[model samples]
Target: MGRTRTFDVNEALEAALGVFWRKGYEGASYADLVVATGVERPALYSAFGNKETLFLRALERYASNYANYVPAAIERSTARDVAEGVLFGAVELSTRFSDRTGCLGVNGALAGSDEAEQARAALIAWRADGEAALRRRFERARSEGDLPANSDCATLAAYVLAVAHGIAVQAKAGFAVDTLMAVARQALEGWPRSGNTLVAEQRL
Candidate 1:
């Protein structure tokens, strides 16, 4: 009879996700994954094929878990609430992680090379799709009388997404959570009010 394998695939993948999340694709070595996942090199090669394959899988897992949090927040709240939640949550997420790794997709885009260009493109596309989705939600909110007709859904969506990316970069640059939060609040408060007014509101 063949001997039973002791390691769990899902658990191993989760561990690998952490290493990749912290060090990124190009930065994470095979030894790093081996150490993080507690799996033998042969087992990793057999299970995940190669380092690129394993990193892609880890990216998928990271996107599946963390990327969805923003959309989920959108689904659970009003348009304004969605915007605020996503921005604030992103800031919190960047800082809350023990390793303080920045956004996985952002890091992937920065570190991935031509060999992994497709993966980087996919991450960029995903972020764009997220912004578009937010624009649609904002449009719906406008139609539902939740926002003023003059509200520019596309621009607001872009602004919010830009804020998110800025937060991610700042987090990666070692900015404190409080600083990011302050930036988020400032962005939120600066959002154009109804009737095309450009004046900023008082802090919430």
Candidate 2:
């Protein structure tokens, strides 16, 4: 039988993910991955196929690991609460891993070249999935009478999604968590209410 692999694959992948998260797809070179993962070029290729494949894995890992707050927020709260939680959660996530800095999905790549196009598409799709989830949650809220009967669930979802992405952008730009949270609160101030305003009574 072939010799058993010595390195921990999950650990190596996490390290490789860090490199990709810090540097976008085009910027993260093979040499960079090697240094980050502590696995040589041959092993990296054998384990993960190629750079694009590795980046795609890293992107997926980032989504499952760090980008899960949107759904969690939607599940545990009111429609207004969902927006508040997502915006604040974005700030918390983007700033938590100081070295990584910004969200992997939102800041994973600059404008894509032909080679980086697939990676860019993967990130966009991940973001889009979150938006879709929020939309569904808002639609449910509207159906259940948590929101106004005439509330545009699609527009509200898009609005919250935009605010979350904006939080990521600001966090990547070095905005403080307090500053970002303040921004989140301000966004809630304009959140469309049912018969009465929820923003006035809510602490968020």
Candidate 3:
């Protein structure tokens, strides 16, 4: 019979996620993972396969936990609301935590090499999924007259996602939540006015 695992999987994964978020894929070594997770090397291998696999799993865990605000924000009243919630929510999410500030997805995008290509690919796919969802939401908003007929939903989606990415990058660079929110507010000011009413009328 196989030996039973000892540590709490979710708890350990959360720890691993923090390490990956702080260090990135290539920067996070096996020693780092083992120390952060409080698991022995052999046990870590048995539970998560390899460093790359562990990083992927940790990245998924981070996404499931912290990266969910985007989807929730997109479900708000208007396309402008979606953008506002997304940007402001990004500020809160990126800076709310002290140790793990910034976005794991954005942080992971830059680090890693050929060996970590799968992890990189996973981050890319995740971003693409977010952009796709945003596009669909904006397209629906345009159809509902929440946005002007000439508004490009794809560009709008890309623009918001890009801004969110910028927020993440800025957060990683030690910007405070208020500073990031200031940036968000400025971005919202540029939100397209539909029906001569600013979409960012609602306060953050």
TM-score, predicted candidate 1 vs. hidden true structure: 0.85
Cα RMSD to native, each candidate?
3.7, 2.5, 2.6
Q: Is candidate 1 or candidate 2 better by lDDT?
A: 2
| Candidate 2 global lDDT | 0.83
For residue 108, model 3's alpha carbon misses the true position, in angstroms, by: 0.9
Residues forming the 10-long window of minimal summed lDDT in candidate 1: 195-204
* Candidate 1 runs further than 4 Å off: 1-3, 195-204
What TM-scores do the predictions have?
0.85, 0.92, 0.93
lDDT values for all models: 0.80, 0.83, 0.86
Tens digit of per-residue lDDT, candidate 3, span 97-192: 888888888887575668888888988998999999999999998888788889999999999989999999999899878889999999888777
Please name the candidate that would achieve the greatest TM-score relative to the true structure. Answer: 3
Q: What would the per-residue lDDT of candidate 2 be over residues 1-204, giving only the tens digit for each residue?
A: 876677888898899888887887888899999999999898888889899999998877777787788777988657888888888888899899888877778777758789888998888888778888888998887887678889988888888878878888888888988998898899998777765435435644
Q: Residue-pair clashes per candidate, as listed?
A: 0, 0, 0
lDDT string for model 1 (148-183, tens) is: 888899998998988988898899899988999999
* Candidate 1 backbone collisions, by pair: none
Winner by lDDT? 3
Q: Give the C-alpha miss distance for residue 147 in model 1, angstroms.
A: 2.5
Which regions in candidate 3 have their CA more than 4 angstroms from the true location?
196-204
